[model samples]
Target: MSLLDIDGVSVDLGRAPLTRVLDEVSLRLRAGEVVGVVGESGSGKTTLARSILRSVPVAAGSLRIDGRDVRGLRGGTLRAWRREGAVQYVFQDPLRSLDPGVRVVDSIAEGLRIARVPSEERTRRIAAALRDVGLDPELAGRLPGHLSGGQRQRAAIARALVMQPRLLLLDEPVSALDAASRDRIIRTLIALRDAHRERLGMLVISHDIGSLAALSDRLVVLYRGRIVEDGPTRQVVARPRHPYTRLLIASVPVIGVAGADRTERAALRAAIDA
Candidate 1:
């Protein structure tokens, strides 16, 4: 069975005539598989992620995690669902995700405390998670404000990993970082997935096609709140079938291009094609 299944899922913002942010989106992720959800801003990528976590209400269809219906859960059941660590989310901004007043170690340890993990085991797991993400254990006591952007992202990842989740939802998790820092974080994520094997599944949402191509096994392109293309990562990157997908892939800046010339030209061509 798939680890995560989203079927005909839709979200309406209840505006005039109800603005549908997501329209009958269906996706499935198997254990150990990494799926990339790629699209421009307002294409509902984050909305999809939020819906799965039950942070956003679904207007239609079903969302299931590990064979259980997410919509059926409530109160203690919902808490239990979270404690089971079936799904985890890493937001775009690590600084925003982490509490300004809390120490990094405590932030990483919060999940364990809520799950009632033993104190000793929690400490060991927290340290290991931080180390796995390429952060020094010594920095655990420092506040989020003290760490570099890369370190903060690593810490956010550590917070998710310490929960031992089966599925992870990454919503533009590296988009806010510098190129060097983004590269490091991407490598760390790939390494973590490799180390976990079939025990983990990931849904990576990003506008950066190059990064998505590097890390995803498959790619799904969302346009105007609907999936327009879905296929293997290599195939989608090399030969995009949908016009929007093609345009997005083409818009990626080539190395050595001065200023906005190449990208602007590509954008113009894409607009013409669209």
Candidate 2:
């Protein structure tokens, strides 16, 4: 069974007119797979991520994790689900998600502490999480300000992994980094995926198709609030069926001479082609 299931889910943001921000969206992320959600700004990309976390209320349809319908869980039960670390969210800006004053290891350990994990065990898990994200275990003692942008992001990912979550929700995780840093972060994610014995389902929300192409098994193109395309990343990118999907492909900038070699063109082409 899939680790995360969101079926025909709809979300209303409570505007005066009460429009649906997510319109009957259905997606499944099985263990050991990554699905990327792509769209322009305000395409309800963030809303969909929140919907999985139950931070945004659903108006219709069902959402489930580990076969339990999250829509049916309320109050204490719902809060408990979030606290259980069945799922975790890695924010777009790692710096903002972390406190400058806090030690990197402490940031990762906070969840363990709240869950009342044994002090020794928490310390052990913190080091392992850091190593999983391709960081030196010793750096855990440094403050957020001491790390590079790429390192800080890795620390954020480490924090999520520390919870031992079955599913990871990554929102524009690499959108803020430079090409080098972005590549490093993506490599770390790939390593984490490979290192896990069980499939670690992931929902990566981003506008960067090229990066998503590198990481996702499937690509879901969202238009407005609807799912216009959902299929293997290669299939959808090579022969996009939806008009919105075509528009999105057409909108990507042509390769330029700066990095525009045959290699860049081919990589960009492979991102969409067979």
Candidate 3:
């Protein structure tokens, strides 16, 4: 069975003339597969992630994880499923996700604590998780504010890793960092996925096509709250099937041709608006 299945799902937000953010979206993720969801702002990428976590109301269709209906879960059952941490989310901002006042180790141990893991086991898992993300155990004593952007991001990743999640969802995981930091974080994620691919699947949401191209097995492009294209990463990048997808690629700033990239991107935006 697929680890995560989202079939013909639609989400509507706000009241009175509700706005439809997701329209008949169907996606399936298997264990060990890394799928990238890329799109411009207001494209429902974050909403899609929220739907999987059951953070938003689904107006139509079904969302299932490991063959269980996520939308049908209620009360303690839903809480317990969430505590199990089968689905872990790494927010775009690590500083916001990790408590500034809490020590890194404590933040990483929070999920295990809520799950009632023993002290010794939690400690072991926390150490292992930190190591998995290329963080030294000694750094665990520091607060989120003390670490560099990449380090803090890894710490956030470690917190998720400790849960041993079957499906991990990352929202723009590297977009807030400098180029070097972004590269390091991406490499860390790539290595982590490679090491845990047998049981771990990931859906990464980002506007950065270049990063997604490097880390994703397949790419799913969202435009105006709907999927415009879905295919192998290389294939989508090499030959985009949709106009929006092509414009997204063209917007990426090439090393020495950033000026042209910006101009093309602006023109594409104008055309899209028209």
Candidate 4:
């Protein structure tokens, strides 16, 4: 059975006059797979993520995890779904989800605490989570404000990882950082996925093709609230079937071009493609 199944899902926001945010989106993510959803702003990528997490009410279709219908859950059942680490979310803005004053270890331990894990076990898991995200275990004692953006994001990833969820929903996880920091965070996520491939599946939502190209095994491109293309990561990026996908690939900055002439030509080509 698929670890995460989303079928013909649609989401409507507002009451009186509704706006369809997601439209008949269907996706299946298997255990250990990394799938990326890419689109421009307002393309319903985030809404789709929220739909999977059940933060938004689905207007149509069904959502399932491990063959269990998530929409049928309520109250304690829903809480149990989260507490048991069946699925976890790591948002785009790490600071929004991570408290500034809290110690790194404690922030990461919040989920475990809710699950009522013993203090001793929480400590061990916290350290392991930090290590899993490629951070020094000693750094857990520091406050959030003391860490670099990349470190803080890694800390955020650790917080989600500590839950030991089967699937992770990441909404632009590295889009908030500087170039160097973005690269570092992306590497950390890929390493985490590689290390726990058998037990973890991930859904990364981003407009950054490079980030998704590096981390995801498959890519699903969204345009105006619907999937325009879905295929293997390399295949889609290399030879895009949809025009939107082509625009995304053409936007990837070609690095290490030192000569002024080649750089100028490449820049012009990118501009033309755009």
Candidate 5:
């Protein structure tokens, strides 16, 4: 069975006349699998990640984790689930996400504190998490402001890892890093996935198709809140079936054609109109 299952889910944000940002979105993530969600800006990638964490209410369809219905969880049960760290999220901007005043160790231990983990165990986990992300344990005493951009991002990832999450939702996790830092982060993720040995699942949301092609086992392409294509990363990158998917690949110089053809864009627009 899939570790994470999202079946025909939809999300409507705002009050009164709700705006549909996600429509009939169905995807699944298996243990030890990294699935990448790729799309242009405003394509509802972040919303989908938020919905999985139950930060946004699902308007339709079912979301299940480990065969338990997520929509049915309520009150203490929901809070407990969240607090237990079954799922963890790594935001795009670690500098903003990590508290400037808090030491790295404390920030990484926040969730454990909430869950009432013993202080001694928390320290062990925090150090282990930092190592897992290739951060030095000695740096844990420093504040977020003191760390470099790459270190800060890895610290944020360590914060998530400290939770020992079964499913990881990384929203544009490497977008803000430099080329070298980005490559290191990607390598760290690969190592972590291998270390987990099928006990963990990951959903990576990014706009960079090239990076996704390298990191993901499967790729799910979203266009206007809908999944236009889903397949093996190599297959999708090598042979994109949808116009929007083609455009995404073409836009990435390192992955496909240097630029998307103007005529193809025009044809896509016409197709959408028809």
Candidate 6:
């Protein structure tokens, strides 16, 4: 069985005609496999992540972790499920997700507390988590406000890691960082995944095709609130099947393409063929 499974999941806001933000979206992730959900803004990628984490109510369908159905969990059961570290989320904005007043070590230790780790073990784990994310042990006492954006993100990652979660949901994790920082974070994430392969599954949501391609074993493309393409990363990147996917690939600026070569005439022919 897959480590995480989302089948026919749908989410909507209020009674506004039940606008289907996700239309029967289905996905599966095995232990250690990294899956990328790629789409433009408003394509329901965030909604899918929220639904899996049980933050957003699932309007319809099933969400399962480790083969246990979670669609009907409520109140204390849901809280317990979350505390058990069935799934963990890393938000795009680390600042928004972190507490400005809390020390970095405290934030990472909070997960251990939730899991009922002993105090001494929690301390050791927090330090290890910090080191795993490439943060200095000395920064443990620093508040989020005192850290750089990259450091804050590392802290957030450490907080999630301390839980030893089975599934990790990354929502545009690198979108808020500068190019260099993003690269550093991406490498850190890759290393972390390698180290925790036996205990983790990941679903990464991002609009950057290149970054997604770099990290994902498989790719699913969302468009207009539905999946337009789902396939192996190399297949999706080299031979995109859907028209929208082709358009997205074409829109990426190519080096050495002169201004005239990027003319409407060329685009028109490409669009026609696509």
Per-prediction RMSD in angstroms? Answer: 2.7, 5.2, 2.1, 4.0, 1.5, 2.9
Q: How well does each candidate superpose onto the true structure, as a TM-score?
A: 0.92, 0.90, 0.94, 0.91, 0.95, 0.91
Candidate 3 residue 119 Cα shift, in angstroms, is: 1.4
lDDT of 6 by residue, 65-131 (tens): 9999888899999898888976889988887668888887887787778778999898888878888
Q: Would you list the C-alpha lDDT of every candidate in the order shown?
A: 0.86, 0.85, 0.90, 0.85, 0.90, 0.83
lDDT of 1 by residue, 120-225 (tens): 9998899789878989887878999999988998999899999889999998978899999989988998898898877999999999887898889999999889
Write the residue-wise lDDT of candidate 4 on 85-144 in tens digits: 878899888787788888887788888988899998898888888888888877778998
Expressed as tens digits, the lDDT of each residue in 212-269 for candidate 2 is: 8788889999878999899998887778787666656655543112334555555554
Choose 2 or 3, whichever is better by TM-score: 3
Q: After the best TM-score superposition of candidate 1, give how far the Cα of residue 170 lies from its true spot, in angstroms.
A: 0.9
Candidate 5 error regions (>4 Å):
259-274
The parts of candidate 4 lying over 4 Å away from their true place are 253-274
Q: Distance from true position, residue 221, model 2, in Å? A: 0.5
The TM-score, computed over Cα atoms with residue i paired to residue i, of candidate 1 is 0.92
Candidate 6's displacement at residue 241, Å, is 0.5
Clashes of 5: 0
Tens digit per residue, CA lDDT, model 5, 1-274: 9999999999999997999999999998999999999998999999999999999999999999988898878899999889889899999999666889989888888888988999899888987898899998778789988888888989999999988889999999899999999998999988988898568899999999988988999999998899999999999999889878877776787887666678867776676546
lDDT, model 3, position 189: 86
Model 3 C-alpha lDDT per residue in residues 1-274, reported as the tens digit of each score: 9999998999999888999999999988999899999998999999999999989989899898989998899889989899999999999999777999999889999999999999999988988898889998888789888899999999999999999999999999999999999999889988988999899999999998889988999999998888989999989988877768878888765411235566677776676666
Ranking by TM-score: 5, 3, 1, 6, 4, 2
